[model samples]
Target: MDVLSYLATPFTDPLMLVAVALGTLAGVYVGAIPGLTGTMAVSLLVSLTFGWSTNVALAAMIGVYIGAVFGGSRSAILLNIPGAPAAVATGFDGYPLAQKGKAAQALGITTTMSCVGGIFGVLCLAFLTPLVSKISLNFSPVDYFLLGVMGLMMIGALGGGSMVKGLMGACVGVLLGRVGMDNMSGVVRFTFGSTSLMAGVPSVVAMIGLYGFSEALMQLKSRDFTVVKQDVKRIVPQFKEVVKHFWLTLRCSTIGMVVGALPGAGGTVAALLAYDHARRTTKNPEVPFGEGAIEGLVAPESSNNAAVGGAFIPMLTLGVPGDAITAIIMSALIVHGMQPGPLLMQNSKDLFYIVVSLCLIANILLLPFGLTGIRLFAKFVEIPKGRLFPIIVILAVTGAYVTNNLTIHIGWMLLFGFLGYLLKKFKYPASPLVLGIVLGNMLETNMRNGLVAFKGVGGFIGSIFTRPITFILFLVLFYFAVSRMRWWKAMMSKIKGFFKGLFTKKKA
Candidate 1:
């Protein structure tokens, strides 16, 4: 089939249009609800669409995948709870913005940026699939280790009051992450003779407790429950606002697509990396990062959605699933008798274009679906804090329980919730802790692998200098270090003062 035929496949078929629209709508709600991830939704749809035509089935799945990824930011913005792991960074500033009565603005900005990011990813998938795949091949274990270290270094950015407190929280998180059996060795490290502990603490459960449950606990202390009334008129962002952040959007989208194309690194990792990049690179924001900066909202929303497109590059070009959702989608394709390897494009070029076209349609449809539900969804924030807190508590508990269907997980959730409460009470930042949990395994596993490959600590250090990419990453680490140092700031200030004096003398 030609390009026109490939593009028209979804738009021309009545069933395909309905499937895409309905699937996108359902995906938004699925993503807004905790524990109902896009992967789960796609998995269920696979069985339902088993007998359907390949084009129709793919259209629905693509719609859901796009909608669900965008939907996650809604809850993260309106509430402290991140519906999905990818939205965790969104919550850092989104919740703060909501508390200040700009929930509508945050939602609008996130929606617009998410659409932009999704489009960028699709464009990359359509035009640069091979080049992206080649770049993805360069990430060895050492590279991943450096990436995780880079993520961990965000402690300085996220640390609210004191760097020491943030480091402490992150250290605790790393210790918590080490609770399970060693991935390389069979011996358990911190199970303490408990069967449930052997599997380790689930990061999702900890996230719900740290963010959702703890926020509820904090609300319980306050008697006044006045809800912030959202301004319905300003629910959609203006064109100028989108243009102002255009460059940041592009940069974050690139980060999202690149990270997403890497096997095993999904939207969660992509979003975090993008958020850190924004925090580091932005010169001056209207507000501090943790205090509702638009940059924070723009970066994660764009990157995570862009990752949806990046994820397809490997699956279509290399037969490698970029992430879990793509893995499920790949399974659905295989069920329909389509192989997703390098030969996939050569044999079924139309299928490749069809997938790309579906993603485009889904992302376009996302704006209408995501924006229209704001009034109704924003009402949740208007409910009395007492009532809302209980509902949030129920959702948090249910989300934790659903993770493994084990009561022990609930215990862990409550324990972490209380710990989170204590940390918040003491003004310690919780984000770095969550970051530690998320990147802990990646950091540990890769460091060990790098050590083994290079024959020890000294060789591992030397090996980084030998590789170009690793060496570049080392330079980035140095920049981060310099950026955070007081001496660097003082030196820059002196230089600026010297320039000011010289300019004044010249003018006089």
Candidate 2:
């Protein structure tokens, strides 16, 4: 359908527009806070939209989805706190810029890049989902397992300062993810017989604790702090700056979409992966990553926004939830009596198009609101940590508790909170742990499926060598492992050698 036709549809009713605006606004604020997530925003909206039309409800939900993901960069840049899991990578450089008194510029630049990434992802979904979905069909169980291994290794390589700590943290995450039921046997593995344990630890609660509560705890540790000073002039980012970083923005957007399209890989993974890619691909590796590189902000901000669009492709084409936000979206669709599969496309073409169209609209709307909001949001840096941390602690507790309304889940969050803080203290990247948890089930499921397809262990092993994709994935895994081990030493030696050569040349 044409834009004009879509505009004339019932989905474009004033009530729907109002809903979209309100939800988007709410999403930005919720996501700006360090604990509330896009999933939570959508989950909350689900209750309020029972009486609304399907398109209206979807428009509202999508608005929140788009806004919340983009909103995460606000805290990431301003407070050194990642407002959401996806924004974790943003803190690598975002906080540094805040300390440098360029928080406004960083926020504005990140917001613009995020909008570009979101729009690019939507375009990809509009045009390339069929092809992307087809590529996913080629992934065998071995390939998926290898992919998980590679993803985990990438996190290990780039996570904090110590590889061992990062790996341990990642292992902890995998163990936590393994707590509920065995994939093939349907037997409970780690659950100690409590009925609540049967359902397993909630990913949201874990994420809130790891990314949210941990941040609050860390802030509480520092009684004396300096607030980020903002300059309004910097908040209105220059067009030239955007053009200069166009390539980085594009690359991160592609990374986000590709990662997000994968089932179970969400914005958090996408952001971290993009950050790793940015670090590797940059010409000057000396730009101290944790010291506030614009590249850091650009990487996560762009990728997370792009992830939203990437997430919808699987939901629309394969009936799979691309991420937790899309999972909520799937539930919302079911609530509206609209099933979400190939049949939905054939039966409700307009509804599908309406969603795709909303993505485009939401991307456009995010820019002005995002820029204006950042200008005002920089003011929050003035809030004292004593007051701010308490508010953050409450929000974190509330967000974690609401997941299942169980105190045990809150306790699980606290456990992860301490774990996350210690990991951070020891220079371990907590992101790898998150990646492991998200991909662990896929790894196990795919391996079982592939083994069953092969009819035996021998055939399964043989297929690894025979399947070209599987072989390629293995090669990538091997490369990542060896390369990660040598990266730091190699880079340091290279720097040392460069200086020696420069001195030798001068002496000659």
Candidate 3:
């Protein structure tokens, strides 16, 4: 009964409804523009909404979150430019569909499946958040340190093509994250005796620079400004096809949710995994995997959308973010004088329900609004980089200054923006760096606290073997670390070949 009332509040509040609607409407267009991402949009929102009421602020942010994620697919299908990383897989078949004069059909199908996946994720968050929260209540500082370790390992190993490069970027981020006053010792760190450094490097500024400004810089390098025009007809997909893919959509959504729950592996990985699942399971694909298979579209579209819900669970319950956007959201909550974790669940159940309700409403709105602006959005995606990048630069500079109204922060933004551009040029993954920065403080504080509690370094090290939870986390961390080693993968490959040869000999 209590949950029912909490869920009903969003619908009853006219202001909340309008905020969500407007945010989602804006998000759809923003996300369609290449180089703009949900994380970037949310970061900008945090600055603008810092002075607003909590519920209204959250409603607007949540609407943008849902809309931006879905909006990425528009550019992917029409221009072969994935608006965000999560839509990379979508472009594989999406662009092909556009070339085949079925862009409208592809857009409709993706919209439907994205909604299906998103709702499925929300349901999982509702049911699993409490369960995860209960388990997190038992976590000690040692366990948290190990969790941070695992997060870094996963981000490095799975975030990019080169694990070494990913880990290097993450290490740099962790070091940068340490540039503030240490809470435990009351000693300044990495400040170079500058008073301004006492407040440390603002994560908000880093986000604005790295993702927002650097992204604009990266996009400006491409000289091809050609836009392919598509004649979009049939904004609705065939009912029979949707019915036929229903089970596959559910399965992919499940994949997405599970991946999204794990820190560092978000929608991109979920979509890839789901796309691979579809290829392996479909006994007969109407078209081969790469060249416009409708199944390809269904798997990635559904899974990535569903991953959004899964991404929020860890953030709301455990205070660990599932991805960069969630990390920004976590920062927003912190700025609003709220902590997200087990305590958040116990003290602010209403807020939790409100977020869930907003997600549901945004997804419902996604279908109609996403479907309605087909032709206009298709043109919107083609807005030339020449005109677009200047506005983005202006927004980035403004967003940085808004963080604390400090001119120095804008310089911080430019510095990080240049560094981010270098990372992009070298193909280094930016996500691991962001994750490293976010987790560094948590990892250091917990390790120090745990050492003091255990009475010494030896006992702190021993705690991993003594505590059941800590021991399990240690093992998981170990596995993630070892799996990234080239030697281990090679050894596993050899072992597999030996077994296969043995089986063949026996059959002969």
RMSD of each: 2.1, 4.5, 7.2
Of 1 and 2, which scores higher on TM-score?
Answer: 1
Candidate 3 residue 285 Cα shift, in angstroms, is 15
Best by TM-score: 1
Q: Clash number for model 3?
A: 0
- Candidate 3, which segments miss by more than 4 Å at Cα? 1-117, 154-161, 183-186, 215-359, 370-381, 423-432, 494-508
Q: Can you tell me which runs of candidate 2 are displaced by over 4 Å?
A: 1-15, 77-81, 159-161, 181-184, 191-198, 212-223, 226-228, 334-339, 343-347, 424-431, 455-457, 485-508
The window of 10 residues in a row where model 3 has the poorest summed lDDT is 151-160
Better of 2 and 3 by lDDT: 3
Q: What C-alpha lDDT does candidate 2 achieve relative to the native structure?
A: 0.77
Give the count of colliding residue pairs in each prediction: 0, 1, 0
Better of 1 and 3 by TM-score: 1
For model 2, residues 366-411, the per-residue Cα lDDT tens digits are 8877877665676666567677666666767776776677888878
- Per-residue CA lDDT of model 3 for 174-257, tens digit only, reads 899889898789999999999888888876567557766776788678777555455566677778988999999999999888
- Supply the TM-score for candidate 1: 0.95
lDDT at position 83, candidate 2? 67
